[model samples]
Target: MTEHRIITIGREFGSGGHEIGNLLATRLDIPLYDNNLIRMVAEKLDIREETARAVDETTLNSFLAGFIFEPIEESSRLNGTEYVPPLTQQVYELQCDIIRKLAERGPCIIVGRCADFVLRDHKNCINVFICADWEDRVERIAAKYDISQRKAADKIKKMDRERRNYYESHTGQEWGSIDSHHMLLNVSRLGMDRTVDILERICR
Candidate 1:
């Protein structure tokens, strides 16, 4: 029997990362995890999916303000309060747990939320980072969402900032940096199909 391979994809905003992940999953006949992980965390924690998605792997400067020491473990509980210091942390842990459980199930493709860092220790893991030119990304986003170019640019900037900040906070590494990935693809130049083909060869 062949060994199972886990592919973890880290992508930049406005890039066709999610679409490529879906295509790869279909081609490889494996489960694809992107939005579903957020749902699972929300269900497990009994929080709204929107809320879970909002804090997924993200940290706030306010939460880290003026604390030279980490909080006592005993004080960390998921209370139904707006000021809870542990809410985001709990969500992040839940997401990580879900990612681990998914990997254990079989070969799968995981997109975003720093799955590469979470499953780095897995022996058969393939870490891929997807990026594209700013103009190409902006155009893609605009076309996909039927938004103006300016709107697409704004959305891309905000989303990338959130993703970058979240990744840096959790993984202690820069998001979209070459060092974090085994392979980096420029989807704008290679296009989606060719990129997928290259990744299939690399992962195989």
Candidate 2:
């Protein structure tokens, strides 16, 4: 607890990354941040939760030529009526600030939204990438959401593409690539309980 440990879980959709993170947090007795973060961000910005989530982990394809990027450290991180920078950039900065704040608060698990890249400089942070076989991913997705295998596969492809693009655009690293993470885990091979146990041992 004194070390301010932070775990960032970067995962493929339907790979049980969220479930693993939640279980890990429960076992470790710490907070797990995932989609619930949208509410926090929304409240801070005084915007609708849907509005905040609209840009969460998503990139803006619209052209913004010749715009200078503001350094993250310089962000005001306002909790106000209106956003300061372009909406996408503003949301990104705000999330970055929240992630840093959460890290400083103490040991916790953060899932997705490029948390690994955001806290890349934190000495106490461990970045993990979770993956599984395509079939395993598809099967998990279909079972959890009551969708057909083909639909699940389509969802997996689209989600993976978005995550890759989001990570690369924000962090300049290949998404789900081993080089980007301290550990690359296959939940399909290890199983969820064993995966959590392995991560616990690693963190210890």
Candidate 3:
């Protein structure tokens, strides 16, 4: 619909959610934000992209916080005498700001980073959750990363856990719950092209 100015996709690992976002963005002539946010955050904080990406869509428990290096800006803000949140929290805050700005700029496809919750008050946004069969996910991940199915399954489990924790921590809501999203699609069931076609139609 014309009112759909922003689309946020929440997906399971290896579910083809990112691919759908890419296809939809291209078909609609809009911007797509995903891993590129890591680059932006890294540049903004003057940190290594790997450093930024390590915390992306992941959280640090108190026990793990001891190992994370605080952003230079955060450390120097109060002459090293103030309490700064964990690097993961700071990254999440920065991402929220970036997501808001991008949404304000124009229509775009934002994949993950809890963009659906971040833009909860934006009237022109549509949030979609994507899932796939376990075997399908395993196969997709294995092919994508050139890893064995067992390794792919392990990676999927880890990533899904991190994403779920990150989303729940920041938004205080379940990551892929039906009530949290406007639409839920099974990419493995519908196939990539058909899923993209449905989303493109929805955006129109």
Q: For candidate 3, what is the total of clashing residue pairs?
A: 1
* lDDT of each residue in 1-204, candidate 2, tens digit only: 236889999999988999999999988899999998888887776677877777777774544321333444544556753323656676777888898889888899999988998888888899999988889999999999899999999999988887788789989998988889999999989999999999888777
Weakest 10 consecutive residues of candidate 3 by summed lDDT: 62-71
TM-score of each: 0.86, 0.86, 0.90
Candidate 1 residues 103-188, lDDT tens each? Answer: 88899999997899999888899999999999999999999999999999999998888889889989999898889988899998
Quick one: ranking by lDDT, best first?
3, 2, 1
Better of 2 and 3 by lDDT: 3
Candidate 2 TM-score over all chains jointly:
0.86
Query: Which candidate order results from sorting by TM-score in descending order?
Result: 3, 2, 1
Backbone clash pairs for candidate 2 read none
> Please, what are the lDDT tens digits per residue for candidate 3 over residues 56-128?
8887554433345554456544565755666787778898999999898889999999999999999989999
Off by over 4 Å in 3: 1-4, 60-81
Best by TM-score: 3
